[model samples]
Target: MHKVIIKYVLIGVLAATALTSPVRAEAVVPLTVQQFFEVCQPTRVTDFVDDNDYIQFGLCMGVIVGLSSLMDLNCQLDRNDTPNHLKADLSGGNTSLTAYRQTMWNYSNDNPSLRSFPVGMLAASLAEEWPCIEPL
Candidate 1:
């Protein structure tokens, strides 16, 4: 009975700490540009391609889209430059995630470079084509 009480107390403490942990809205490290490249190596990409690892590919795409959304929230994306169609699609439904994933894969494949990070590159491509007249 004592052990059971201690276990419940410990769980409650952990839950409280987790809930109260400081989570900044913006990260100190720029994930899209640097972390993406570090994590998504050419070899990994190749492995996914060769294996047709849809699961892994989907996970990576999800992360990229998430990062892109964060960038958008941080006023990094050019909303003004984004086409109405793209914006509409992105805001419309879950299908937009697929669209972004396709774009990321094609962009990453065509523009392979040591300096290029797939997520950052994709974000830049979108910005360049549909740059906001001013930062949001």
Candidate 2:
């Protein structure tokens, strides 16, 4: 009696869930590696800052570096410098995160294939833009 009722209720619940699950399954569109990069790439300078004008480039760089690092994409930084460390070095009275973001954005446009690991491209760009000068 009671057992029979509970068994039917469970079956009904299972059937209902099975019918609804396909809707969620269909909503998730799978993205390829290139597509993922295209979607994640920075579009504008404001993407790296807020109303306060404080640097948010670290966060954007973190997501780019973090995902690539986890994927083992070989996006190593020069001397293994972290994003915050790099941003700190780049920061100055005139230079801003916006400039850094724009530089990265331009690099991304010129070389779309490197999107999987942009930090490598960024390191190269930084090296070009500001070569080290040793004092004699």
Candidate 3:
């Protein structure tokens, strides 16, 4: 009976050590917007086959508008960079375009409520504006 108890204790200890051992950390590679676009291209192509040109143009315009708004809002929210470091960088132009792309992608994926209404409005507005452009 004592031997059986000792065997179980040893097994538990081994199991605990194995479970707690540090995992090999994954290599972190920072992705660029182009790479992200490429990863998402197939889905975009399939989804917007008919409105590809309009969709692309709208995305570009939306990003520009969103970033401008973010800057304006940040300036009002944080006069000094001390409290909101990321907001300060975003407002100051230290954050790259890739950051904005990543943010949009994250918002679209993580929060449908944040996505749907704005996207619908943007699409409608862009589609209305599309025909006014003279072919280059």
Candidate 4:
């Protein structure tokens, strides 16, 4: 049927466009600071945003919340040296998901040079805020 043929063609074009898009291509890996910031940070004022921004904001919150939840689960990277271990501490904090997203965005904005490294960027911001207690 012509309709079926058109549907397949449309799907193919969409797939090809996603594959060829630089942003989508790089998204296969963990989002780096630059990537995270670009996706998460709204370029326009809230009132001026188009419907597309809802998708962007939703995606941004999802990533931020996922990362925060991992931290809450006490994600740890232990180095041989006790003091070098990384962990999160969300005790007694009233911080919301939006706060976490903003904090991360700020960190990314402040450190453009570290944009390529996701974990490192996380370590510098989230981990540093509430690091693990070193054992004696």
The model with the greater lDDT, 1 or 4, is: 4
Best by lDDT: 4
Candidate 2's displacement at residue 58, Å, is: 7.0
* Lowest lDDT 10-residue stretch of candidate 1: 22-31
- State the displacement of the C-alpha of residue 25, model 3, in Å, after optimal TM-score superposition: 46
In candidate 2, which residue pairs get closer than 3 Å at backbone N, Cα or C atoms, i.e. clash? none
Model 1 clashing residue pairs (backbone): 78-132, 81-130, 81-131
Reference-based TM-score of each model: 0.39, 0.37, 0.32, 0.59
Order the numbered candidates by lDDT, best leading. Answer: 4, 1, 2, 3
**lDDT by residue (tens digit), candidate 3, 1-136:** 9999999999999988765644312211113333223332223334554444444535554554564455446545545542332232334346554444445455445444443243322222222222122223
lDDT of each: 0.48, 0.44, 0.41, 0.63
Q: How far is 99's C-alpha from truth in model 4 (Å)?
A: 1.3
RMSD of 2: 10.8
Candidate 3: deviation at residue 124, Å?
22
For candidate 1, write residues 18-68 as lDDT tens digits. 656453211223245444443343334445543234444544666757745
Badly placed stretches (over 4 Å) of model 4 are 1-30, 42-45, 75-85, 132-136
> Tens digits of per-residue lDDT for model 2 on 20-133?
765433332113333323433555655534422222333455544543333222223233443432322232236544455455556566777776653444544443443332
The model with the greater lDDT, 2 or 4, is 4
